[model samples]
Target: ELSMSGGALRTFSRCVTCLARIGSDLVFQAYPDKLELHTLNSSRSAFASVSLTRDFFDHFHLPADAYADAAPSSTPLQCSVLLKSVLAVLRTPTSAIDRLNASLPNPQASKLEFVIHCVSGRKKTHRISCSAESDVQTLALDRNGFPSRLAIRPRDLTRLLSNFQSSLQELTVIATEPAARLPGVDDGTGGKAVELLSYIDPTKDDYDSRLHTQLWIDPAEEFLEYEHAGDPVDVTFGVKELKGIFNIL
Candidate 1:
């Protein structure tokens, strides 16, 4: 059993919904201190995770008492649900929700329930069927190994993307010490990607439009939030998935 504030639920739902856009299944793993939802793209090129601690919720309960010998935090109760089903429940307007309760009587049960407690005491329980297949394993990002990194605010991204043409599906991240490419590797798209990076070279006029956030990170300075060691790296992703992620942010 679990109860989270309406705001927390909305935030969690939005984040998870975005993750769902990148993958088909949402894997929820609960520990004593936190809950985590992990998802990975089919190509395994893109992955995102949301971790919420007990402090993030008003109340959190784990049925560990039912099993005397069961390991607590070490043994996480995990279950996978279809992305669309989860998204459907989250699509409801947040103003109507006051709190949320999620539970799994049996970790191996075929379904899980999410009860939305509304401000007016009107509640709705959504039963989402659990998947029998094992959850997809995600690749651990080696931040220390990535040579290049970029930081931008959500609002900045939203504004920048607003200028994007509808026909643009993929964007290239061009990095450079001497002219590099973003998504340095190929994504599924066959056409050249629309350049989404311009901060690598400060001399370029488009640099401001691309990295207008003014939060660019250089290899010389140690980034407290991120660790990297290598050469400039570029990556690509679908704009649709990016938009979903941005919306959650």
Candidate 2:
């Protein structure tokens, strides 16, 4: 059982909405110190997780018997629920919500209960059915493993992407040294910059006619932290996933 109020409740709502946009299923892992929510895209190529410490909740509890039979290395109590169903219960505006209390009677329980307290002194209850047999998926990538890293505000990146067509599906990011010149830009200044481009297959019949867009970004000014220790690299990924993550920010 756990209760969240004020800013914590608001954060929880935003996290759920983000997860809903990423996948069809929401996985919940409850531990003694924190609560974690995760989701994996249908293709299993993308995974996202949000962890909230005990301090984030107004009240949190874990029964001693929740995992009594498990070894010390056993996993936490985990369950999966339909993202749409969870979203339905959390769709209420955060301003109208004063508090949210969630409870799972036991590991064998088939339903998760949520009680919402509104500022008007009104209470609303919702029960979302969940399954405990669903397989858990996790990723083990290390952040330090990447030779290049950049930290930029979400709004900054989102504004840059706005230049592309709304229907654009993929985006390519090219990182290069300060002396390296980008495709179209001929500015002589040897300044560090990152290139963002809308990508479509070159072999497509309408390739030449399709809109081509690119944006040059000065990393020194836009990124809070930028580091590249290897050769130039370009990565392409779905823009829809990025928009989903930016929405929460």
Candidate 3:
């Protein structure tokens, strides 16, 4: 309480309504000796997907919006519209990929593009994060909250999306290997100017932290060549499992 520690260790939780949307209750807590996160969920299981993601951004305060609405027994932050997009971008990944290892000229960045019909079955939401590129790239987030497995790998994307119209979808990421603080290691941004986004914590701030990695993609021209050059045999987007991941948060 503010009166208990002179505001040094004050915490509280409550339920709230936003934009006419009746949301679940929220939780809040603060401690002087350490940083604490407050999360409020109607059900204990409701927050499983958001817990790790909240901590990921809290370290950087990317949205830094009110952590949550006051919930009767939940921890919640009233996040900004921009911050709300964070969760949709962090969900499970599906690889609709059909090909990889094609050749093309190397530019300042790499590009990847694909599309899922999301047809004939259960529609699920997907969240994604990708590398920055010469042109800003965008990952898709399903409007609904439910997420299916990421169906495409950066490589298979070439084959899977090959059937779709070229103008329908695309992704580009700058493959910059930034400069390393160490004597001979590269930083991985490829010596390009890095944008100063405060929400993105640098490697030095938390040395042991694992950074978000982007998929390596080649130019669009090479993949596009498959379009006009062949039959619809190269691309295949199907119900398949993608390996090499721990778990989707």
Question: How many clashing residue pairs appear in each of the predictions shown?
Answer: 5, 0, 49
Among all candidates shown, the one with the greatest TM-score: 2
Ranking by lDDT: 2, 1, 3
Instruction: Indicate whether candidate 1 or candidate 3 has the larger lDDT.
Output: 1
Candidate 2 residue spans exceeding 4 A from truth: 64-74, 119-122, 132-136, 177-189
206 in model 1: Cα distance from truth in Å?
Answer: 24
TM-scores, in order shown? Answer: 0.68, 0.82, 0.18
Tens digits of per-residue lDDT, candidate 3, 56-87, equal 22122212233333432333222112212322
Candidate 2 lDDT by residue in tens digits, 24-84: 8888888888888988888775677888988989999988888788842356887788889
Q: lDDT per residue, candidate 1, 38-101, as tens digits?
A: 8877777667788899888888887765345667755577788888898888777788889878
Candidate 1 Cα deviation (angstroms), residue 227: 4.7
- Residue-pair clash count for candidate 3: 49
Worst 10 residues of 1 by lDDT: 214-223
In order, candidate lDDTs are: 0.68, 0.83, 0.24
